[model samples]
Target: MVQIKSSKYLDFLSQFGVGGAHPGGLSLTMEVLKNESIDETSHVLDVGCGTGQTAAYLTSRYDAKVTGIDIHPIMVEKAKKRMKKDQLPVEILQSSIENVPLQDAQFDLVLSESVLSFANASVALKEIYRLLKSGGRFIAIEMTINRPLDKTEETDLQQFYEFQSLLTEKDWIHLFEQTGFQHIHIHPQPSQQQDNAVLEDYHFSESIEPETFEVMEQHFEKVLKYQGILDYRIFTCTKG
Candidate 1:
């Protein structure tokens, strides 16, 4: 495999046209949305929306007005194409979570699946808070460290995943509080050992860049190495 030197770990998944690039994937996303009271009048924002899978689902399932955003131009284009192909009325934009160009307090729901950890958590959370209407829900499924990582472990994770912080559950809660979120609830997910299966079943696009495979290899190695220490959690918070 050709070696790639990109620090943005998500670029690899994007290049391969991977949809639902998160723990539990689209199945978990569907399960979580089943509990949400979305309707045609509801406005939802999907942050770091890879290929617009969740956005399309929300639009088709709930008939909700959905907006999907990703920092990567390629991802945005792919998401737009996905919505177009599915005849979904979702808007796709290329933007960063820390600096979204949308109006403040406009969305009734903001969804982030495996997204916040890759960003400066504090700033990104504050932005999420700003974008949400009062009483709006911010739902995130993200990677969290089960215990404090040692220096070497931290370096490896940070370098491989481009993680801003491998925060523990408590650390995540504290940041949510500081960012003015209320009614916070966290549910830890059991680790499912299926990295190899996921890779094996991945539907690689014919146009996939060679560098993506190298990054995917690095991602797989780190995930296997840190399987014992890494965990994922779903957090639901309300904007006060």
Candidate 2:
């Protein structure tokens, strides 16, 4: 596990009223699910549902029943608060992606956003496969490496993103197939305007050190080279 040094890494969402994950949480989520024509009739399982952004949106926008799970207690608690604030009936739990506290085939859909890379991807895939109902849709926007990089390039990953063992597009497809997912659809995203002032404020002076800045730039460049490694990729799969 990568060292989670700052509890405030994502605290900007609550502090500054940003949508947090994926910036435009609800719209982005809907766009990702729209391909599958998901609606109020679906039951969603959100792996690593950070602050309940996607969960709240799913329930409110589509009237879907959503269950959100995360490994961090603080994140889970914040998600619960967000659900209550939005008047959504979302179930949030502090649990790992490898060992979710759910039964088999309980969900009509599964969603993950920029979270799976932190876990052992294979185990996470297996867990997602087990929890999803037959024909259930698994939709996600994840962080991934476009291709294998040299040690120097790999070392450019920031402390927070270091835990992410991003696999290539081929690896992603293989993992999905190996986990018993069928009819996989992958949509690659392109880089867009970046307004990282919030994150910059959080890091303050540390954000400008030459070495640190180089690493950060390299990270973004790598992501850009592969269409914003974490910013791109929407996948839909069916449980077999």
Candidate 3:
């Protein structure tokens, strides 16, 4: 088994139990899911599922059999609780994406939102490819760096997000291809206008751990400073 380093940043998100931490939030997830062919027969996996929001949506909306996996135990617990409360049948597991504790070729769709950049992208992508059945789809929304990051900016981002690797749009496509994924599609989300109102809306959870809060503060600062360089992308691929 591969050893996966625990991320304090991820721990923060799990502790706060944020429902829509991804770029476009749950609303965007709904829009993307709308285009996919999902139903009672589809077996879906939500990689790095946080608080079970997307998993619950998949079950309630499409009635698909959904399984969620996250690296944090607290996240798994919270997700399971959310599913139980909503009376949705979702199996939530606490495990790293690089080494998911599940059988191969079991899922028709694998969904990841703002997840891959934080892990060893190559390893995670390979695992995702292995988990999908032939012709299965992989859809992900992830943070990307459109331009080259200076040494200082790169160091700050790594420190703030504990990201294993930050890739450009091209880099992402290369990795997907190297992992034997085909029919790749990349869509970049429109950049949000950086305004005072948006910055003001940024708030840290009071319940977050003190250490996590400090990191969050640093992350917020960097995001504000380098807003133009940071990008969010949606990728869809198929395993042949």
Model 3 lDDT per residue over 29-86, tens place = 7778887999999999999997878888899999999999988677777888888878
Better candidate by TM-score, 2 or 3: 3
In order, candidate lDDTs are 0.83, 0.69, 0.84
lDDT of 3: 0.84
What C-alpha lDDT does candidate 2 achieve relative to the native structure?
0.69
Off by over 4 Å in 2: 1-20, 23-25, 188-231
* Candidate maximizing TM-score: 1
For each candidate in turn, the TM-score is 0.90, 0.76, 0.89
Clashes of each: 0, 1, 0
Q: What range of 10 consecutive residues in model 1 has the weakest lDDT sum?
A: 194-203
- Residue 75 in model 1: lDDT: 74
Give the TM-score comparing model 1 with the true structure, all chains together.
Answer: 0.90
**Top-scoring candidate (lDDT):** 3
lDDT of 2 at 126: 90
Models ranked on TM-score? 1, 3, 2
